[model samples]
Target: MPLLRLIMLALAYLLPLCVWADSIVMVAPRETALTRNFVEALSSRLPTDTFEVRLLSSTPAPDSASLLITLGQEALHWRLRQPIVTPTIATYVTLDGLQQLHDEVRPASVQILLASAKPERQIILAQLLIPRLDTIGLMFSEQQRWQTRFWQAAAIQRGVNLYSRGIPGQDQLPRVLTNVLNQSEVLIGLDDPALYNAENLKTLLLTSYARNRVLIGPSAPFIAAGSLSTTYSSPENMADSVIDMLQETWRPAAIRYPDRFSVLSNQQVARSLGLPPPDDAELMRRIHAQEQSR
Candidate 1:
């Protein structure tokens, strides 16, 4: 029985190695530094003993993968075109972008992690930055018109009036923006690239500045481009959020926004508009308290 005991001990040691771990495939459009960094961050958070993470660029996810994650809109669009059998999570997509894709065709077994901050959070930031703020202006492209209701609801909840204008085409921006600016005290930029891309962002900033109105709520990059303020999540924040979601038991398709975010403000822009910008740390604390209270 000494031989049997040796075999038993060997089996005991090997059995643990034989145990199956869940495999997750993360697909990005291309292997850029940004995508690579995100994958590395996410992988570091997962328990190495229980999870195996793989990053893919243009390769099909193995059928054996327990879960599939699409890193950005391009990767998500590519995945949706295929027959998705694996449970999928899509990140780095704006809520409106996801909605647009969903409208085209309902994706199966997919959960969404919206890249944009919640509308309420943006509205709260705007209110806090602009003293006695009464009315906020918003401009949207034809594709982004649906977002107006969300912004309106958030504005109403914060007891501020919303003045929204729709631009059917870029040609209509000058006219539409003038009307929106004329009626509202401050303009809020949405995450829609069609309405707020580099080509037109300068115009928007210059026009708003000339009118002595502040622009808020665009992505973090726009803060340097003269947007007064915005709330944004970092790569680490996104990775932490994804790790938390993975730890939970599987559920039906659900949508989640980043629980952790950072507030960005341009003091120069605020000063230009004659509004005092609150300290970012203090502003973040107030925002957290407001969110918790609700």
Candidate 2:
């Protein structure tokens, strides 16, 4: 009937307008596959037409626009008045060159040590990595005024023995690590970039193993390769956190460690560097289900 046809035509045009009712403003690190995927997944999950994703080298302070989703590794920060936050999307702010997680875990009386070529981001990590650690060590390239005070304050609060050995260079770290091992239970944190770029990964890992130290790094691949363990935040969970934060507009100035992924012991890596992992019945079942569900 002509009357029925007219009604259908009007509904078609109205449907699209109704679909998009909200919007979120996203600011993340420059350009990368992960960033692209984050935009796609987040946009799809949002209740908006255009979830306007803006790419910037750094995430600036929040504006009066829509919700602010920042990804500043560790080099950037913002001044924000705390507001109610309903974290539905896993939005991450990569400030100071470090990406964070939706959750955090604080270990017991753990010793946290750091070695980085740079100061800003490295110092921030050291502080975040501090409360969880019982002892904190500083081996950085620049010991500017702020660096000294930061380390000093952390030491007083935690009563951690703050040891500062000059930044160690390549082929020279194994010996330095050997010396430090005599005092601490764990050697968690990155070796100075001056040393990392100066030496090969194989050498660094081998040295870490030789010292029987539990090495922890921010880079995921390094953890899989040989580090004792690492705190990780997957893109999936990050997406969830971002949604939650955006739904209620709040950027709580805090850091969170990602989920914990088990590491391959030195013994395990030695067993089969080329073969698939040893079959764990429970693990395999979970893996199979996850795959089949997909």
Candidate 3:
């Protein structure tokens, strides 16, 4: 009888241990290089027993997962369509995309690791690059008015002026660009393609140079195309954000930009503007120090 009782107690203990091993479901829409890199970085940070990656189309997740980490917007869309009660953490999604989803879903446990850097981060980096900077210009479509307002408020709090314009259509680009660049020392680009499409980016960069205005943007390509600098997060930084999210209690569904960032600068562009360019290492250190001081 004592042997029977011992066997039942052992079964009860092992059951929860087995269940805990399969508590996480990591989903990605496709098997692309970016997805692979994110998964690799994330795996290195999280323990093997903590989570498992699965292809969104092929794998059926367990009935209940403690956490659902979606790699991109498509995976997030797929997961939201299902009857999932588990908390979701989305990576590589833009703030605009995440906000649209939030408006539609009004989900409680959904969170995002936004692709773009926060406005404060951009403002600080721009100030570092151009110490005399007082006014920053931004061009966005009417759909992004909310974002513009958010940036404007953030800039005002830091004692900087935000000269932002809402373009109604592509036809107003030249006129609006000329007007804003005239008053602003730096032009910061958002993730909006309406303002920075392939056809318009060259002209925009050229216009900023003509006005002696430094252009700080979100993508590395902007630096390659003669912008002074860009602020973006790396895959490793994203892994750290995810780890932080998992350790906390779920919050309201919202887009959260990365706390850590990498800044890229074009030395040739800086030289052409007669501005001294700081080395990447020194620039990063200064930014980190400023962030810590704040």
Tell me the spans in candidate 3 whose CA falls farther than 4 Å from its real position.
1-22
lDDT of each: 0.77, 0.41, 0.77
- Quote the RMSD, in angstroms, for model 1: 7.6
lDDT of 2 by residue, 189-282 (tens): 4433444332456765676566554444534456567753333345554565444433332223434332211211233643433323333343
- 279 in model 1: Cα distance from truth in Å? 1.9
Clash pairs, candidate 1, are: none
Model 1 lDDT tens row, 161-203: 9999899989899889988999998888887889899999878
lDDT of 3 at 275: 88
Q: Candidate 1: misplaced stretches above 4 Å?
A: 1-21, 49-58, 103-108, 249-251
What is the model-wide C-alpha lDDT for candidate 1?
Answer: 0.77
lDDT of 3 by residue, 1-294 (tens): 366544543343334322332466789988998878888888887678877888878866665566678888888888778775556687888866765674457466577788876787788888888887789999898877768877887798667999998899889998999999997989999878667778998889889899888888757678887788877878887887777765554565766887767888899999999989757767777877877797
Candidate 2: count of backbone clashes, pairs at least 3 residues apart or interchain: 34
Output the worst ten-in-a-row residue range by lDDT, candidate 3. Answer: 12-21
Highest-scoring model, TM-score: 3
